[model samples]
Target: MSDLKKEAESLHKAATALRKVSHHTIKPLHEFKAESDDLGALGKLGSLLGATEDIREGMHTLAKLTKQLDEEWQAEAKLMGDVSDAFDLLDILLAAAAQAKKG
Candidate 1:
C-alpha cells in the first residue's frame, strides 16, 4: 500500500481509539457533581459529544478503506501495463528475427 493509505489507516485507528476512550472512559463534569434545572441539558450534551466522536471515527475509517482500495487498484493497473509492454516488445523482436531468416 502507498504511504498515504497507510497513514490514513493509522489515523483512522487513532480516531477509533478516541471514540472508545470517550465512550467507556471519558466522564462529564456533570457525572461528578451539581444538578441544575438544566441537568437534562448536560446529559444531552454528553450524548451529543459521544455521538459526534463515534461518527467522526467512522468517517475516518471509511476514508482510509477507500484510499487503500484505490491504491490496490492502481497497482494492478500498473502491472497490467507492464505486461502489455513486454508483449509488444516480444512481438517486434520475433518479427525482426523471422524477416532476417527469410534470406
Candidate 2:
C-alpha cells in the first residue's frame, strides 16, 4: 500500500510538471495567434501563409495533447477519491462489526 501511494505521489508530481509545461506551451501559441492575426493581411503575399498553416497545425496538436493530459489528471483524481472512499467504507464496517461484538 505504501508503495502504491508512493507511485501515485510520483505520478501526481509528474502530472503537475506536465500541467505547468502544458500551460507554458499554450502561452507561446497564444502569442503566435496574436501575431498571426496581426499578419493576416500579409498572408495573402503567400510567404506568411505557410507559416500560418504550420502554426495552426502546431496549435491543434498542442491543444489536443493538453486536453488529453487534463482528462488523465481528472481520471487520476477520481480514482484516488474512490480509493479513499473505499477505505472510509471499510473503516465504518469495521467499527460496526466491533460494536456488534461488544453488544
Candidate 3:
C-alpha cells in the first residue's frame, strides 16, 4: 500500500478513537438526578415533592449550561483545526511548486 493510504488509514483509526473518547467524555447532555432516599417514612409527601421538583429544575439548568459550553468548545476546536489545515496546505503547495520547477 502507498504511504498516503497508510497515513489515511492511521488517521481514520485515530479519529475513530478520538470520536469514541469524545462521545464518552461528554456523557449524555440530559438532566439526571439522584433518587429520593428521603422519600421513605422520613418526610411529608408535599415536602418531598417540592424537594424533588427543586432538584429536577437544578439539574435541568446545569445540563443546559453544560451543553452550551461543550458546543462553544467544539466550535473553537474546529476553528483551530481549520487554521492548522490552512498552514499544512501551504507546505503542500510549496512542495508542488518545487516539483514543477524540477520538471
* Per-candidate total of colliding backbone pairs: 0, 0, 0
- Can you write out model 1's per-residue Cα lDDT over 1-103, one digit (the tens) per residue? 4343444455445444433443442244234322322235446665776764555455556555655665565565555555545555666676778889996
Error of 1 at 10 (Å): 37
**Model 1 misplaced stretches (Cα beyond 4 Å):** 1-49
**In candidate 3, what are the lDDT values of residues 2-96, reduced to their tens digit?**
34444545544544454454465464553132222233333576475677556556766776676677666566555555554555565567678
Off by over 4 Å in 2: 1-49
Reference-based TM-score, model 1: 0.48
TM-scores for all candidates: the values are: 0.48, 0.51, 0.49
Alpha carbon RMSD to native, model 1 = 15.5
lDDT (0 to 1) per candidate: 0.51, 0.61, 0.55
Model 1 poorest ten-residue lDDT run: 29-38
Best by TM-score: 2
Per-residue accuracy of model 2 over 1-103 as CA lDDT, tens digit each: 3444555566556545644554555676567655654555555564745676666566667666766776676666666655655555666676788899999
**Of the candidates numbered 1 and 2, which has the greater lDDT value?**
2
